[model samples]
Target: MPVLRVHLDSDRSTARRVLQLHQEGKIHHESREAAREQVWRRGHTPAGDPTFVGITNGRRHVQLLYDVEVYSDTVL
Candidate 1:
């Protein structure tokens, strides 16, 4: 299974939104810090990979990344 790493800002709303999205079938597995670190340990870059997603909060907005396979209306 793929993994998604989510980093939210101090604002709790953003994190809630991400959780909601995940539960709503808009995203695949939620990424854990440990999991992400493990991937990095294996010498893998997240960019252009179809098995990882990275979500972060920018200076003023939220950013979302989804695996190509999970970028659809169907749930995982």
Candidate 2:
């Protein structure tokens, strides 16, 4: 499996967008802290870069976290 290393864009607009995605249930993490912790614990390797960070349910659901954007992945 390839690790998706997420890099967050620390800007106002991006924050708003992330919040919106969370509200819409596009982002499964209950909070940014949880997301951060998960990433930290998983350790950012294999992905080798922050631009491709993501977390998955080990099934069909995957969310890709890119700079200033969040994408819901339908295909693994």
Could you tell me the C-alpha RMSD of candidate 1 in Å?
A: 11.5
Instruction: Give the worst 10-residue stretch by lDDT in candidate 1.
Output: 67-76
Best by TM-score: 1
Local accuracy of candidate 1 as per-residue lDDT tens digits, 8-32: 2334465556557666766333433
Q: Relative to the true structure, how large is the alpha-carbon lDDT of every model?
A: 0.44, 0.42
How high is each candidate's TM-score? 0.30, 0.28
Q: Please, what are the lDDT tens digits per residue for candidate 2 over residues 1-76?
A: 4444454434444455665675666753433544454455554322222332333323433343542222333122
Please give the range of 10 consecutive residues that has the lowest summed lDDT in model 2.
67-76
In terms of lDDT, which candidate is strongest? 1
Clashes of each: 1, 5
Candidate 1 CA-lDDT value: 0.44
